[model samples]
Target: MFELLGIPPQVLFGQLLLGLINGAFYATLSLGLALIFGLLNIINFTHGAQYMMGAFVAYLLLNLLGIGYWPSLFLAPILVGLVGIVLEKTMLSRLYKLDHLYGLLLTFGLALLIEGAFRQMYGVSGLPYPIPDVLKGGQNLGFMFLPNYRAWVVVASLLICFATWFLIERTKLGSYLRAATENPALVQAFGINVPRMITLTYGFGVALAGFAGVLAAPIYSVNPLMGSNLIVVVFAVVVIGGMGSILGAILTGFGLGLVEGLTKVFYPEASNTVIFIIMAIVLVLKPAGLFGRAR
Candidate 1:
């Protein structure tokens, strides 16, 4: 079928697979962005830093404590989330009453500081994280050879995305969060600990970025700058999907990833700018974003 378009099946499917993998990361990262924006009303510029921290923590665990990717996979996010908890309690919490731009500026400064510290320590070179033995091989599927690790990344991302959506969009806890976002004073009047919930929500959002970081460590070089470029794309995804729309963020993340991948196959030069182009069109056509509800 692909041959009809002068493209090989391998080339076509390969790009698609790659796109899905990129989408997975985009989905996870953007979900966190939406969550923070929705519940906390803060734009966490530190998210990319937290993600870089996740990869660094994984690297540290493996080198210093003799832990591997599997254990670090779970531990990295938890550790980063804890750091987020501290930041929320000490810094982010105070900014809640201020303008949202203050939060963005503060977090952006934090991001730069964290990235600079890591760069000072590790230098600009990317440290390598080997793929685990369990996911070392690839299977040939006639059309293409599917990598075990890449498959795991996509599957894990999907599961994580769905699980987060279910938890936030369906559960009782989610109900409280929505209510609190709507009116914290009213929710507090009803006996919910809205303040604490806000803190946790920020941590949880940061943890998602950390989660993406851990997943990305093996695929890309684990470096301080790893999250820099990616976060811009995720920000674009948030805009395209409608900022603060959780499900919209997830769907748009994966959808754009596929679009990006296909662009690479069809028009290599345009691949880099395709997402931005979509963003421009979306801004003009639907400034509220594709899934965003107007206030």
Candidate 2:
């Protein structure tokens, strides 16, 4: 068998698998950001904070309330989503009529506030989340061993990305939401509650971030700054995939992850900046992004 980029097949495949796992996260996170920007027209800087909150929320529920991963998986997102809803209603909603920069700044401050509060409480230490028993094994895949939990993460992320795409592209409620995104006044004139829809949309977008956080809790350490650096990469993925299309966001996320993984095998030094380099290339070649339609 030809070694991939002169690396051993085993090492190559392992990194690729890990890359796909990280890509799963990128897909989910970027998808949430894309949904928020695509519909709300707001660059949500608080997204990373919200993702961190979801992981922290699960940790707290597990330690303080005796809740486990299974329950927290659903509860954490809903709880964080409520927090998002409150933000939209009280602050984000007020910025809809203003320039997009205002919303971005507001969310940037909000991210700082959230991360600071959590860092103060948790002290920047990583908390471990126990994996559920049902998802705790591994399968031998000849070349690489596949952990059940990581596999679940990829599958779950894909299911979510697909389901969201379906809902947005094929559903009646999605039609209304898209219409509201395009023109709230016209949507409201048609008897739809556009403001409420916006609130729910923001909530839902952050909820997806929360869901990714929950899935990530078991694999990565749950920490206040967990999403800090990760968010930058996710933003790059969004730019490459294009905020104009959720499917584009999802595809770019996973694709870049694989690319990153491959790069790690051949040129370890470039692992960190590969995605951004790709983003720069995309910006130069296609400002609208891979899947984004030209404005």
- What TM-score goes with each of the models? 0.98, 0.97
Q: Model 2 residue 6 lDDT?
A: 66
- Give candidate 2's whole-model lDDT: 0.90
Residue range with the least summed lDDT across 10 consecutive positions in model 1: 1-10
lDDT per residue as tens, model 1, 58-142: 9999999999999998999999999999999999889888888999999999999999999999998999999999999999998
Clashes of 2: 0
lDDT of all predictions: 0.91, 0.90
| Model 2: pairs clashing at backbone N, Cα or C within 3 Å | none
Write down the worst ten-residue block by lDDT for model 2. 1-10
Candidate 2 residues lying further than 4 Å off, grouped into runs, are none
Model 1 Cα RMSD, 1 decimal: 1.1
Scored by lDDT, model 1 comes in at 0.91
Residue 65, model 2: Cα distance from true site in angstroms: 1.4
Candidate 2 residue 214 C-alpha distance from true site, Å: 0.6
